[model samples]
Target chain A: MQKIFSYSNTMILLLLVLCAAVFYLTGEMSSGAELFPRITAFGLAFFGIVELILSLSRKDSMEKPIKKENNQHLVRKSVLYMLVFFLLVIFFFLCFPLIGFEVSAIGFMLIAMVLLGGRKTLRLWPVAILIPLLLVLVFRGGLDVRLPTLFF
Target chain B: MELFGAVLNLLKPLTFLAMSVGVGWGIICGALPGLGATIGIALLIPFTFGMSPLVALPMLAGVYAGAIYGGGITAVLLGVPGTSADAATVYDGYPLAQKGLANKGLTTSVSASAFGGMFSALILLFLAPPLAKASLAFGPPEYFLVAIFGLTIIAALSTSSIIKGIMAGFLGLLLGTIGIDPIVGDMRFTFGAVYLYDGFPLVPLILGLFAFPRCMVLIEDLVRKGSSQISLNLDDGGGPKLTWRETWQMKRTYFRSAFLGTLIGILPGAGANIACFVGYASAKRASKKPELFGTGIPEGVAASEAANNGTCNGSLVPLLTLSIPGSPTAAVILGALMIHGLVPGADLFTKHAEVTYTFIVSAFFCNIIMLVMGWYGSKWFGKIVQVPTYILAPAMLLVSLVGAFTVRQYTFDIGVTIGIGTAAYFLSRAGFPMASILLGAILGPMAEAGFRRAMLIGQNDLTIFLTRPLSLALVILTLASVFAGWRMQKKSKPMKDALSGKKETQ
Candidate 1:
């Protein structure tokens, strides 16, 4: 056998399990309010089951080994890049209210660009500096949206 | 006449200034790969609270119209589509660019978009009330069926796989249940978090499903082929220039696709992407030289451009007449209206007639401005695709994060956005349609409310849906749609494969 399950089948199974678990955990509530959740969960599980069953009929082929290997480097790099991005975003989120939009905005943009492309993107200096300032001017100055503040 | 008066009132300097700014921002957003109109509207919702309905509606509508049209530039000049709706445009548009007929492709696209936008707007103006009047007789059971009809059509036509699309939609409905119950204030899946009480905010969910997934795709492209630049040369422009004659020649394609787009937009769950696909496919099928499609053909550009742009007004039909958003971005627009203390539906036509008429009328003028902007600015807007990934990625992420934060001014919303975005990335890789998921989320509340209302009205009798004529008809339509989708898949297997092969090679 190529595997116990295909990748999609595994995800479908996982989703089915989540549905069952969520439905079971709902306990007893006003029947009407719970009705939508119950119906949707049940429906999702039904489709998941169908997907799982259909996935079994698919035969995995080891075709195009060279192409797969060639793609490995790019896929790995891209995954790493995304992880780094989200981590930076999370840090920005954490520091947002405390350090304020102005500081975090500049830091986030500069750090993220450097991480993604090194110093080759120094040419983007103007755009990098201007965008966040423009956002502040529009949201804070023009619209009077109250951002978490450090400096006026 | 009242609508004309409302339009005239919006001719003031302040209105034009606001609209110009909004349209300019929208064009820039639509030209960028990861940023689309939904985020544009989401960020603007909070800001619109400060402006009058007259000023706000025109500005938002201008943004809406401009964003839809602006996508044509990148689709023509670069192989990359500015928006998903413009993906079909990339098929013909990019080929024209490679042949140095970029101006022709760009002009055809802009003109098609303008025609489609104007046609759909006229339909909305003339057809909304009658279409809505037909729904006035509809009650709880019919409402449930209407929601079900939306889900069924999405499930059937949105993806290559019917079951997967339905599952994706169902997953959205499940997420929609995360907040407080509409009928009874009990929280089902809040898991003891105060944030869950309001459910997942639509902005976060939309970004997660629609916007963030693109980031993942961008990452793959960036990694596989490091950032690339567009090759531009106006002196070497070798292909036939677009003429008024060619524009008129494609009028048949324009009308058919425009009508198709508008009708699809009127359907609750349908959006611009689906409209473009159908329009392009139908255009190819109806062509004498269908073989010429995707070969930098003007007909191909016309179909996609018109259909995708047509959906703007097509979607407004249900949004204005019924208060049900016809697309995800339209849902964001609905939020804008809500903040301004204006509810859609019959009340808008009566109590807020001025605002309603102005909003509808403003869409017409917005399209005109969009046409002019797209025609003149194509050369500049088309250059946006050449930006380095490192630069584009950070800018898009920062703007998106900031927009997400501004909505509720909460960090938790950002978490939700990122989490959902990650899930959407994986789901898309696994072949689930994100549009279906978005539709599910948007339609969930309406479906739930309708079901609950039906139960209360019918005293727990499930037969009420079957007993009501409109509901029963809708139920049949839903089933028919599913069957039609099955047949379409089976019949088009060879054609679809052939088309994809041709598209890739060209």
Candidate 2:
């Protein structure tokens, strides 16, 4: 975990520097636009250097051999759960305006909740209906904020 | 006499009513699990739209002050703090409740909170004018230095690995640099996506990065623990509550914590949680009975309550003076003001002095409300712990989603929030400081803008930032802090190594 963390930090820093370099070049090439990106670039590069130096110094101390105590933990399940939720969110965003806010929110919540563990059908049905309706009414009615609605 | 007149104006019938209602709503919200000051203020902001910004701003200020103190009720009685600001309160408060001194714990928390809040308000009332006057002289170079000063503190507070903290801060700045350029009007990294034009919506991104990821962790914990059932009992109302005599005994502790919290809160990017944590640690170190801290010591409750409440008021300093929010709750309040068409800055004090002063005075009154409400409502509010997470989690998620949508009626915002939340979860899992990262994002543009402008004015000379007196002083301060943090990390290395070695041997 520590090694992965270090590597990710370095890669992110490098990516930022690369972007900054691009911005630097595309900018006015003089004191106008280029100046800011260059300053930002150096700021990032300095911080990156500091991080790299610190990580190197601690690498020996951080490198403890991993101990595996039964790999059957919910770690995999949690990651999969996150991935599924992400996909569902993307789908909802794409489909919500088409199907309408009320329908999509209800559908998404019901599906997501069940997938997470709303096995009690009695509880699930009410929540599936009530939650979305309450949200729509409160937002649209109370705040006068409009949602993408199927009904006029 | 001027202060008295200002106070009197704030005490007008409508303002008083607004303060009471705002504080009352805040208390209820803060006591409920998963709902906090941020959500409470967000929900109330739209309602305040009908009123003058003067009236609405004070009411929201009242809400902000009330909510921070309100969290302590659950922290003491239920052993569950409703907000992160109250997390330190449980260190001493729960133990006291378990020892049948629940009334005393509640008393100390309420009193300390009131005292801290009042002190901070007093500071804001008096100190803000001078600060605003000084800020009138600040140019882009000075702002850049100030931003760096704020970022340096992250390294100081960063846990164990400063590297990860720096990484988070840099990543936040990078995030800030996305979207269209503020000065040149050129698109930087939007990739022709209009959602990227407005940059990341601060509300949704903040909510996701902070709140959503926390909920995920809570869910993960619950899953691992296999439906852990929690039993909660309200504090017994039998004993004589802490008297003024006991309060006086801890006056020094209350004062110190409040002062430290206010200072922390005034600094851009520092929040109530950090203030409370530092207050608790400092109090423990300074206390005669340090070992008794987590076991329900009055000092512990006093320190935590004082600091958290102090931070609430302290955040207003920068908000009113510099137009920069000191914390997330403050950021939300900024949003509320914007929704009401009240742009914050220099002319606000001149153009809206009455409103500003009224808001400050209302903050003072807000503290009193928290004290009174905490005393009378603790028994009722403690009942919230009886509510199960299965019901609470979904409701909270719904609110989160709605709040995100409200920022911009686009589904793209919802996606951004979920994405940021997920990324935050992974970053936290890998030991990064999300707060630092958030702070970086919040302050990055300010720093970048300032740096660029300074360089331009100086004809591409880097020395301009270092040559000016105020800017130079800030740059030195930032470098000094960085040096100090580096030294502290080096010092702790041997101790951490020994601990790890001992664990291995065991």
Candidate 3:
């Protein structure tokens, strides 16, 4: 049963459902406005259904496991690292408006570096501190594009 | 001649500086894993806002040309491809490096890349103007069909599964229909968000789709590998150079691959990644001793490198002439063109000939600059692969997010980038091709506008597309492209399976 519902097939199913929702939402739009969206939705749904069917019928529907028994710890660590990175990004974005770009970016960089196994190196400290400052100078001072800095 | 005038423009101090910086930066970015030509150009687009089109467009072109060549450096030194375009180069390049012939491989790559790039630049210089002139005759129906044709070709060829590829393209089309309708001005799917009113901003979307996911992957790799430092035993000393006789011997391979690459590049949706493989495969077939092809040979490196870089300017032909981007990098360039208030097609040749010609002429000098820099800097570039993934990944994300913010000065745009990027990462993991989505998004408005206008012109006559010769021809071509893509997928299945099997074993 797990083999029958592969990742690709699941994605196709989700896309098909999204297409149906899109098709349903177009009812509020004018016929002239909805024409293209409806057609696109129809096309998406059709192909998605075909893909789902094809994927389900294949004998090798399940992707071959490339992971070795010994690599489980490594794989788990990689996923954890990815989650930490994603959370750090979210935290950076959330903090940007509150604390400002320079402080938030530098903080994000330092924490990310440490979390991603850069704590052992002396270079990480300077890199985390200097990159944001350099970027501030380049973007705000050089390019004249305003960044969200707390102080001028 | 305008060509001469364009050359003169490129020689200006500022323009020349911009071109050199773009090329050098492009090389660094391309040599780094998880950052390729698409992200390189996307990250640079924000900075181009303050420059004149003359400086901006030429610089982007230089980056495009240089990055394609730069990927070969890492391919030779490391088994990992810096960019997908360099994947084919890895077959011979890594073997050569293993045999202590890294210098010879690097030199062959630089020379071949330069030659192919210059050849295609010449072709673009001559071919684009006539094509632009011809495109002037196209009506809305023709444009509609052309957009359809582009979408179909992109969908069919981008992935192994035609169904999946087309679905991805249609998904792009659906995403593209989110904003107000072109003809009626009715908000179709804005859902009350004001940022959604203008549709998804191109810069953030590009960065999100192409850049963020790569950064994430780099972080993942860092965790799995458990080492920031790559053990390097590179032979930096001058080993053996490719003599004139050796270069002359491979001249046929260079020319044939370049020609094939250029033709593929001129086609909408095809890109350097595909061209490199095709070029390498054809060279293998034609080689007198095919069995010796991937055994650390200069000819194999030359074939793949030349074809990929040949696509640098070749992909710009359709972009400069028809307003259709031939590849993902070209799509980003198209966004840059729009940002600079330059439209594609006939006006690019007439009203903006100076800018257009300067951009084209810059490609020639870009190749020369790349050749010189790559020759001298290959050793340094090889070391770039050793940069800590922890630092590199976070830095890229920070810069990309900030760049996204600078696009419209809207903080909301940053969120957009993150969201789209997250979704794109998952989708890609599920075997969806990002290129198809990008093409669909870029071509969606064009397709819709053309379709609506043509309908109005024909008073709702569906057969209006069939009435015109060009429109009918485009329709046939679209179908033929789909058929070809299907056939190619069927033919390439064995190869793909073999390659995947090899990877699993490794």
lDDT of 3: 0.83
- Weakest 10 consecutive residues of candidate 1 chain B by summed lDDT: B497-506
Residue B372 CA displacement from its true place in model 1, Å: 1.4
* Candidate with the greatest TM-score versus the true structure: 3
The models' CA-based lDDT, in order, is 0.75, 0.71, 0.83
- What CAPRI grade goes to candidate 3? medium
Candidate 3 regions off by >4 Å?
A62-76, B233-238, B281-292, B501-506
Better of 1 and 2 by lDDT: 1
Model 1 lDDT tens row, B353-463: 788788887878777777787777777776666677777766766666666666677878778888888888777666677666766776677778888899899998999
What's the chain B TM-score of candidate 1? 0.84
Q: Against the true chain A, what TM-score does chain A of candidate 1 give?
A: 0.81
Task: Rank by lDDT, highest first.
Answer: 3, 1, 2
Candidate 2 residue lDDT tens string, B1-506: 54576688667787777887888777666766556787677656545655676578778887787778778877887787767788789888888888888888888888888899999999998888777777778899988776666566664555456656666666677677767666676666566889888666676766676656655654554454445455554425525578888888888899999999999888764668767888899999988878888988888999998998898879878777765667757766655665565545565567667776777777887888778877776666666655545555555555666667775677777777778888776766555666556656666767778877887799879889878899888888778867776676777677556533111000
* Per-prediction tally of clashes: 0, 0, 0
Q: Superposing every Cα of model 1 onto the true structure, what RMSD results?
A: 4.0
Best candidate, lDDT-wise? 3
What is the full ranking by DockQ, best candidate first? 3, 1, 2
